[model samples]
Target: MKEEHMAKDKPASGIPPGSWPVPLGLPLYVTVEQAAKLAGIGRDRMYEYVNSRADPIPQMRVGRAKTLIRTSAIPDYLRRRETA
Candidate 1:
């Protein structure tokens, strides 16, 4: 049997050297301020939306102290506004 030699620098599946894995879920790291900017709303308005029972709500509370928003949700939020 021939021995298989794998390159040390390449990923196990042979994905190209410079390629990154596609993100599986939404990118969720924006601050409330950043989310507000992306939503084209004021920070206080974002707080209102977070407090309301609205669909397409982008903000999520992680643990007790950390709050985050998925970047992918911004477009949905904007579209919701347009249809409202």
Candidate 2:
């Protein structure tokens, strides 16, 4: 029974068994605050990351005040931050 036809199941893929595919069907853009929540970080911290010179999270300024981040950028940022 352990041997299967597929490569791996949901849990092995880091997805809960009954959970729906996420971020896959999510919007491409999200506000800075929303990005923070998605990344499990504080809004203030997200802004700090945005302002950091070392490795800032790339973001886009919509119009004058709205700041939006690309949905893929958050995970990409984390992947870059991964040391081990």
Candidate 3:
């Protein structure tokens, strides 16, 4: 399904699947795809980083339907990579 259409059917949380978790003015949490876009990475690579136990990026999941990554956490992950 197209990413935009992913949210056509609202989940139990009442929030759309692909929509941003935070309000318009605030940019705290974003969907993994959005995070990937911001970080200049592919969605698959972002998911791999999040799923990798060795150095997984922080994430929030809702019933396996929604997954969100903190925008702030991205920098921390990159910093760890730089140091290591």
Compare the candidates by TM-score and give the number of the best one: 2
lDDT of 2 at 53: 94
Q: Provide the clash count, candidate 1.
A: 0
lDDT of 1 by residue, 1-84 (tens): 122445565667777854443244434567777778877899997766666775636677888977787777667766776743
Would you list the C-alpha lDDT of every candidate in the order shown? 0.68, 0.80, 0.80
**Model 2 lDDT per residue over 14-47, tens place:** 6576454335667778899999999998999889
Error of 3 at 24 (Å): 9.3
Candidate 1 Cα misplacement greater than 4 A, ranges: 1-27
Error of 2 at 53 (Å): 2.3
Residue 11's C-alpha lDDT in candidate 3?
67
Candidate 3 clash pair list:
none
**Candidates ranked by lDDT, best first?**
2, 3, 1
**With candidate 3 superimposed using the best TM-score fit, by how many Å does residue 82's alpha carbon deviate from the native?**
3.8
